[model samples]
Target chain A: MAELSEDRIAAYAASRLPGARDVAVSGLARISGGASRETYRLRLRYVDADGRSVERPLILRRDPPASLIETERHIEFAAYRAFHGSPVPVPQMLWLEEDPAHLDYPFFVAEELTGFESSPGALTGEAYDPVREKLGRRKWTILGEISRADPEALGLTTVMAKVAPEDCWRRELDYWEGVLDEDEVTPQPIIRAAIRWLRANPPPPAQKISVVHGDFRTGNFLYDAAGEIHGILDWEMAHLGDPLEDLGWGLNRIWCWGQNDLRGGLLPRDQAIAVWEQASGLKADPAALHWWELFNCVKGQGIWVSGAKAWSDGETRDPILIISAWRMFNPQDRAALELMGRL
Target chain B: MKPDPDAVLGYLAGLMVQTIAPQVQPQYLAGVIGMSGMLLGMAAQEWDRAADRLVKENRAIRGLFRQAERVGLDADLAQEVRALAGGQDDDLRISALESVNTGLRAALISLHAAVETRTDAASRALNDAIWAELSASTSRRAYTGSPF
Candidate 1:
């Protein structure tokens, strides 16, 4: 893989901006905790055809040699573009380059939503105590907006594969289960049992096939001290599926970072669900939501094991992979057990 | 070997977080150092418990296999269960115990799936026992301060 450099980024920016001169890239630094991609924060400066100097802080996400999850970059780009100005907040996507010849790997650049916090650990501090509830409300409310939005209207269906309402659970379950089958370093008897339970008691067909932001947990979004969400990020796993899948993922117990009953370490589970229901104008049928919650646990385990496998196989040396695997594997199993009423 | 590995690792983790991470250049490297500290802490916790956990779990799974005979599994599965149940964790090395543990757990999954199909009272009792064991397995692996 080609190493990311200021000159290479400048060259790519120059190519993208026709008639622009003296293009320069500076302050290029890789950011932390994006196990799926190599994310860099850089400043782009150039003189455009209009004879105006343009400068902007941008984020560059390039495909790594091995990723925690396999996803199509273009589809992720399209997802951002689809929701840029919508009710759901997302960074403005600037460019999507698929030709690995340009930067040694496919990548995309987007406007950096700076001066906000995204760490789940940050939310656990006393500084955020006052705004936690407000942030929690906005969190699930935005998720509800996403669940209510039509993939066809967002032009997402064109890029994302379409799925029937009934097959949403099966498709997602199959994909993640196959991930476990391929990448699990250790046998996951608990997840296997959960899978069997899910198959035995399938949820009612999705009320509607809405865009499922494959990962909608607390840490995936940017928030302010005032408890307002500035941008929703990490849509690499976005797809057309049952809207409840997103709901279930958000309500997962593994996200309760405070070690309390607060879902996502933000709001009580009932309050979050109520906020979501009110915003999306949809009913979260208890049984169906329960089914999706347990299914998300299985999906969660699949991801943790895959990271462990990637690290063990010498595919990537990123410490985040090993950290996440070690920290999350058992909690994920316990989450599954709780959901299955086996805990 | 003068100092215990867990103590050394714990001290190293504190050093990384309290000293090295803050001094590291480039935000990315700093974050890596901090997380490396966390991984070391987890390793420290697991080092003392891995062998004990694996041995106890191996014995528990063998017990389950023995009790599974009443469920009337198929010939091949029955033979496999019997073979695994008869074994003991004589080699106390972590690697050896883990190897045996994996095979036993795999067979346990097969037994679990088969047992779920039968509706007899014996099957029901065995199924309950399996769930109890599974729940206990999570308890055995649970880390202190775990979110769950």
Candidate 2:
């Protein structure tokens, strides 16, 4: 795999756009921190149908040889498309090319959301500190919109597989546990113990099946200094499941980047839940919410172990894989134990 | 040892953030170097206590496993526990201790699951001890920068 040159990418783009002329690409540089996909930012120049020259900043996300999470790109592309102009903001998906010949791998292109901070650390800085409350409100408010939106009505059901309202917990638990069963390099007594307890004591059926943004926590969105979220990114794990699953994931202790019990480093867990409940019109039964909270720990462990496996297999030499495996594996187990009352 | 592991890593972290990271091309590699520096800092924090913690935990687990034998655990589990309980650390190397620790923990998980469902008071007590040790194990590995 030689470096992905702008000329090559432009050539690929030109073939796709039949009426386009003077297709050129520049500023093609890889962006860091996306372990699951190869992300790049570039400026696309081309002539449109009216012969007007245009240069637009775009983002390219291509599948790596292996990923931290094995997800279908088509689903993610469809997910972004579904919520593009809705209350739950997302980037405009321009094209999805599955053919390997395009850039040596399947990739998707979207309008690059620019000039906005995406790191959670940015939220703790001076500029954002004043608007912390505003950010938190908008954060949960957007998530509430996602929970409140009807997947079938948004045409998401056509792309995402349907799940029974009652079977959401079982499907997620089984999938994550199966991953641990296959990829765990060592024994995970805490998570294994949590799994047994979950099976023995299951949560009630979901209030309703909603679009569960499987990874809707802080640090996965683009926000400006004024507390406006420009885009909700990373929908690779998005699926149709229990709404509380997304809510519980947002409350996972790992996202408490501020080293406190404040959920998502913004509001108290209960307050965040209340805001979400108020907006989504869903009841977050304490016991059921607890079940999903622990389940997210298992899911976290599964992701970390999968990243370790990817690194050990020599598929991707990205250090985030190793860092996640080393730093998160134990913390995730500890989270599970804390939730289980065993810590 | 004169300069100290933390001091060395602290200096390297400065170099990464201030000098090396700024000069790297292909932004991903630069970010990797920055993260690698952070990993070095974590490794420095672990370096001094790595061997001691392993030794302490190994001894602690063997003690728990020996107690498991007295609770009338199944023959296979008892034999495994007895063998591990009588084991001694022949090598002081961190890697050697870590290898032994991994084997011990694998056995510990089995012993815990075996005794968790038993009806006897002794089995219940042994299970509680296992859970307590597991909790302590996590605390020992916890770092100042841990998100949890």
Candidate 3:
């Protein structure tokens, strides 16, 4: 594994850009907080085919040796490319390399939406107080747009495995349950019980098999001072599943970062639902939505426990795994309990 | 032991989060260091209560197993619950206590699932008790910085 030097990245970019010269990858320092990938913000400078100098900010996401979740980089790149110019604000994906030889691991590069905030802690401050409601409205409205998309038209059907609307719940539930069974270092009695309940009573067929942004919580997107979401990032877990699944994830109580009653710490739960319904032109059936929300809690636990297992086994010594397990697991259980009416 | 373990951890965590993290470049590493600091802070909090919480929850789950025996359940499940109820956490080490807790809670899941199928007063009472314990367990392990 070669060191991730600027010279190496510059050479790789030069190779990718035909007829381009003086390609330099600079300021290639990693930005923190991505548990699944090593994310970095870099500057790409080059002379284009027209002999004009060009410079742009870009993001590099490379697969880690082990992570909280497993996902396909090509599918993520395809997802961003497909939704690039759509109502959804996804950064334009520029290059994808699967051959780990280039950077010692598979990675993809996309245009960075610079100067936008993605931290939930930042959104809850006095600076954002005035526009929190506006941000919430746009946040879920964008998700609604994603739910309303046609997977086949977006070329996602080919990349993301197709699933019958009726089988969506079973597929997601089984996969996450399998994750829990394999990765849990300790017995998860609460999540296990929730899984049993989810199996006994399943949600109805998905209204549509839209792209579920496997993680659409508050911190995953880029926002601004005026409460605008510039880019919907982190499509690693994106797949074709229930539209309500995305909605349910956004509405999960664990995301209430403001420590208030607001869903996503932005809007009331009903208000968020109404905004989504109006935007997607789809009804959020109460029972089915409830089922997905609880299922997401199970999924959330699976992810947290997997991180714990990865750390416990010395697969990765990253402290983020420990932080995630300590902060997330208990809340995930409580969220499931709340959905089950046992809280 | 002169300086309390928890106090030492707190000082180390503060250094990482407040002092070292801010001095680092590449904003992401700083954030990671900051999170490491927060995790250590929470760990310092957990250090004092780990064994006590595990033992108390283990005893509480064992008590539920005994109650599950009274609530109508299948022969195998009843036998499992009775066997769990008969056991005790003789080892107070956190690792031993947690290992025992896992087994007891796994059996409790089976017992709870069995009790859910029955409609008698005893089953309903046991169901209520199970929910209460699960809720209590979460609260017991609740970190001060819990997202909820």
Task: Name the best candidate (by lDDT).
Answer: 1
| Candidate 3 global lDDT | 0.89
Runs in model 3 deviating more than 4 A are none
Every model's TM-score: 0.98, 0.96, 0.97
Question: Which scores greater on TM-score, model 2 or model 3?
Answer: 3
Candidate 3 per-residue C-alpha lDDT over A20-86 given as tens digits, one digit per residue, 9 for 90 to 100: 9889988888887469999888899999999999999988898988999888999989999999999
lDDT of 2 by residue, A91-181 (tens): 9999999999778999999999889888887676677668877788888988899999999988999999888888999999999999988
Docking class of 3: medium
Candidate 1 regions with alpha-carbon error over 4 angstroms = none
Candidate 1's displacement at residue B54, Å, is 0.5
As for TM-score, the candidate ahead, 1 or 3, is 1
Q: Between candidates 1 and 2, name the one with more favorable TM-score.
A: 1
- For every model in order, the fraction of real contacts preserved is 0.68, 0.53, 0.74
Lowest summed-lDDT stretch of 10 residues in model 1 chain A? A252-261
Q: Write the per-residue lDDT of candidate 1 for residues A1-343, one digit (tens) a residue.
A: 5678999999999989999999999999998847899999999999999999999999999998887899999999999999999999999999999999999999999999999999999899999989999999999999999999988999998899988888989999999999999998888888999999999999999999898899999999999998899999999999999888999998888899845679999999899999999999899999999999999999999899888999999999899889778888888888888887888
Question: For model 2, what is the error of residue B22's alpha carbon versus the real structure, in angstroms, after optimal superposition?
Answer: 4.5
Give the whole-model CA lDDT for all candidates, comma-separated. 0.91, 0.87, 0.89
